[model samples]
Target: MPDPSQKRPVIALTGATGYIGRNVMESLIDDYDIIALSRNGDAKDNEEHVEWRSCDFFSFQDALKGLRGADYAVYLIHSMLPSAKLTQGTFEDMDVILAQHFARAAAENGIKQIVYLSGIIPPHEHRDELSRHLQSRLEVETILGSHGVPVTTLRAGLIVGPDGSSFPILAKLVRRLPAMILPSWTRTKTHTIALPDVIHAFQQVVGREDVYSRAIDIGGPDVMSYQELLQRTADIMGKKRRFIPFPFPTVKLSRLWVTLVTQEPKEMSYPLIESLAHPMVAEARQTVPGISDGKITYEEAAAAALDEEQKKQEEKKREQEEEGSKTPSPVRKLKQAVKSDVRSVQRITLPEGQDAIWAGDEYLHWLSRLASPLLHIKTTRTGVQQVYVLWWKKPLLELTFDVGMSQSDHAIYRITGGRLLHAKRAHNGRLTFLQIPNSRECIVAIHDYMPSLPWVMYKYTQAKIHLWVMKAFGKYLRRWKHRSTTDTKAAPRQAMSQHDSTVR
Candidate 1:
């Protein structure tokens, strides 16, 4: 619990887009302002109190800005399966360099504490016997603590989540492989935790003075072998595996085989295969209220993750159906002077109603991307008007569109003014969002009159444009559904605050 006397502390979270980081953000959002650091780039839309900061973790100066202005900075970045080839030493060496840079920046920024999530070490810690993955975790922990800020290290074993790397790999193998050619490594005992448990553990350590500057192990209560985990997961997935133990150890060969079977990259599979030999179990766990109490069983965890995943899959299917229904029908088509100039396509409905507001946002994002590869867009809001400046290929062809009276069900926009005189000729442009009679599906239609272009050219060109936009819009809807589903998995926070500032 945070002290009521002090203001809500800001948490600078690295890897905010990662599995653990995202979950942690959702878990602690009510208690702290979040800074989501990601490589691909964070959304620029101003979220309430969550500020997204972009940083190149390798460069101290680059990370300095993002690390600054925070009471606690959660270090969740790791390169187990490095996306890029390492020119210097190994992944461990790169990890150490990154950690040193982060620590330096954090100390300079006057960060109160640093929380790091690391891989769990086996019950019996042998420096010589530690896997490369485990060794890297320990080394990074030491480096972060070496700096001025107090470091809270929470080491976890296999994390089971819907989209997590480990559980899916095991589930996929069980689902795909007819029978298991079990290797000796399958018998190695390791602790495993549900994704929720890991999130809980991170939150539990946030401002706890007792846990600060100490290494703590966190895992689900159950400890089991790889074979048991595989079998139990298979059972939950309703797939039975016939395991036959094989005495052979072809560590290198297995990596290639896993890549071939699982279709995962060597960078990801190689490290995972190499790390399987170690028995990863926690030696001791810190007693935290939410984390250490009332643990769920492995079977229960697997079933719960799978159940939630199944719901998401179903919701996505519904969203797809809703998007497919948006096509304009023959009756909805405008009769133009040239028949070819007017094209309308329409199709069918989902049982659950999709949010009209979200559909509008999707349409906007789709429209912003539809026209050209070289096009750029700038959006600003003034009072009730949404101003969009579109540069089509060249600055000379720039168009400024002013959208007014926009609502969940409909919106009206006109070319207002631009460098091109012909744009002013465009008028009465309206996007109507209609809900299917009794279904959750919505039909979004955009019909505008552009008298500036020749009727013949307008007809065919408009049809082509509509077709492309429809295809692109379908993809955008899919992405939206995916993102929304992922957000829900975080279990949300009341009055959640996210910074509108996004980092890429």
Candidate 2:
């Protein structure tokens, strides 16, 4: 219990921009003076009690400035990006460097304790690639402990909430996928905690002194599989979803499929899928009283997510209707005309002796080539040396091709250029195309109706696809040079043929 008479602690928190860190910040705002550290330090300034500071944990000396006069600091930062360009070192090594720096900073500033959120890796469990993520987290915990700051480490899994990636993606997938062909790992058991429970756990860590310098695994009352969680989510959403489990499951492939449908980043989904392969249920049967006094069931968590999603949808619909009413009919029509075209082809002519046209064209091709990989697309030049653009609406699903399976049922393709445009989706095992005039460029957008999917994947895919399409247009211009050369050579032959025909 928090004592009213006690002096409110000045707490410095890292990862204030992240999902979990956001929630932790919100919960602790009224209770403590917070110096929130972020890479950009661009969080909203509405919270009167919170002071934002920019700090790169990679540089400890600068980050330590924020920790000065802090009573407790929360380390919620994790480099989950598989492609994060950290200094050439092991994940643990990088974590150790950051942790040591943070610890030294906190110690110099007279910080009393460090609170960390980490995933539980049960004793005797084999350390694998997935375990490395958890190991790095634990390494940071140890580093903080070595600084003589009392460390409270809470190990949790699958935190269910409105803004969290785990539940949102799961809920979206369950709602969007009417019939799910699941991997064998779908049956593996894991524990999950609700967002409120997670917040409460953090609150307990901050208020209690006895629990300092210790680690505890926190979970809900029930342990279940991904399949079970999906079914429960469907039930909460009032939808019936069929889930069929395959005997042999490849989690990597599964992760790719989810990435396509949900638009979650590959780095974020990879650890999740890999961890699901192993049972993450708690080893001890008894619950820790200090952590969770009452367990929130999976069903309840699903219901909360569903409720939040519905509320958001209603709010969005209202906003759209209000905007629609405010626009004049002519303006709306003009906007539609500019935005709708589907298929566009432009031809360019270059001077016989100059290469500027070809150079400009090649620049476009390079741009598209660079962007295509980010969308997980393979680019190939045709025999004509012309660029041919072909991509699925959801490119992440292409990973299923590795397993000889295709998401033909879920595939969508949209092509729009100039004044012609078409959007097609697979329905009844056939492509159903929707024609819209004035749509331009191929913007491969995932239309997941469910709110559970991660937004990062969608934004990243959209950005990559737009960049690649622009590149394709650039390549098309360069191809014109070859056509011009051929046309010049054929000009004399055509004239001679016309003269010979006339004489005959």
Candidate 3:
């Protein structure tokens, strides 16, 4: 028995409402108090030993506030699903921003360690050619430790869980499809782990100083191709699913087929299907003690997942019957229907030795010149930037500098209000110019921007124009590399110091 009077350490968990997060939070409750962080924290039920706190990872302030008073943290955040109605960047870029904020916040709050769940990376040679999904995972893993916080990274490939997007999609495909064409990518070998094993791994690692800053590759007892995984799932479910060998690794067709047959959104299926082409088997050297000794096989995992899924469905049905005629709020219904937020992320080459501050200033100056009389940028006395159309007094967009969030390497401008934006939204839309460290590259991104125009109209007009502008800017930057390094002088301003007054 434990000491009755001892205070329990709090473990702050990002993605606390997610599938793995829910399991981990429940399993570890006996050992520690859980600070469950979610976007809709106020709405989440708080049980004993669990406290819900709203956290928007994109916001550094929220990240810091959420992690306060927590001894350790579990980072299970991924930007696969949009957090805003109008997310304006790629998942990879979005993941970068979130990781940076969380890592920095953890450091500021004096968090002892951060346990991150990531995908198993392939060998060195194939890393360069990794799928976007794996690449994003690697980027996140790197960023989490950048703040000097001891990070315990558990790298997993396919997690066999009942509720998550991956396993459920596979289970649905096997149950629904009588016959399937197994593409060449499906032959690639990968490791799988049961959901419980993953939860146990988190239990073992959180606050374990010994495993701090160590990365352990974890998987189940089975090492098999995706084809084998599908077939084994079918066998466990007692279904007769057929497979025809597809000669070509047609990932596009496979993605579509998986989405169509499984009835999962393409957002979930596309990246996963693309990743099947790679071998995701774990290496022997990265394994540690308790986590490596996991005994669940693929078949066992499949059975458990299917059983849990059945139970979940029954529970959901029961709940529906208990609450008859309950309806979602009108605001929620409106949000669901008008979720056509625009997200555009582009990577442009940074001139050697130039930082994000310099790049941002140059962008404004360059845009003013490039668009000329048709589109011009004007700066307010308060340093806010406004874009104007030909002879129009009202600005097309308003960008206010977020001094608190901006640094030498990263510059952030909040889209406070403009004629081109929706009146209300979940988050403050922001434009960021980030210079990646130790590399001649920068990411110019827009996030959570809800366009005022209809989705169809904005997609065709402003969206296309934005892409074209970024592309042209990229080409122009590349041309600077060949010029006499004097282009830096053209920058009209520098990034405000961190101590500068912040503008709301």
Q: TM-scores for all candidates?
A: 0.61, 0.60, 0.89
lDDT, candidate 3, residue 456? 80
lDDT tens readout by residue for model 3, 1-504: 123588888899988878899898889889888999998897878889999998888777788899999989999898776555555557787788788889888999999999999888887646679999999888788888987899999998889878887788888888888998888988989899888889889888887788898889998888999899889888898889889998899998989888888766566678888888888888999898788556888888888889988997788778778988545443355357444565567788887777887777778768988999798887876778889998888999988877667777778878987799886766567788876555667888886678889878888898888989898999989887534434333323333532453442
Off by over 4 Å in 1: 81-89, 123-125, 285-294, 313-504
Candidate closest to the true structure, highest lDDT: 3
lDDT of 2 by residue, 1-504 (tens): 445588777889898878789888999987898888886676457367788887866444466676777888999876554212111223444455457668767887888778988876656665554455676676678777875778888887777887756788887698679999988988977788888888889887884788788887888877788888888778778898888879887877888888888877655666666667766665564246867543688778767867887897798778879887543343244344331111211222232333322233233344446556543333222101122234444322211111111111111221221111122422111111111111211111111111112335533553355446644654554454443444422322333455457768
Q: Where does candidate 1 have its weakest 10-residue lDDT segment? A: 491-500
**Whole-model lDDT values for every prediction:** 0.63, 0.59, 0.81
User: Which parts of model 3 are misplaced by more than 4 Å?
Assistant: 1-6, 86-88, 319-342, 422-427, 481-504
Models sorted by TM-score, best on top: 3, 1, 2
State how far residue 31 of model 2 sits from its true place (Å): 2.8
Cα distance off (Å), candidate 1, residue 415: 45
Residue 406 of model 3, lDDT score: 73
Of 1 and 2, the candidate ranking higher by lDDT: 1
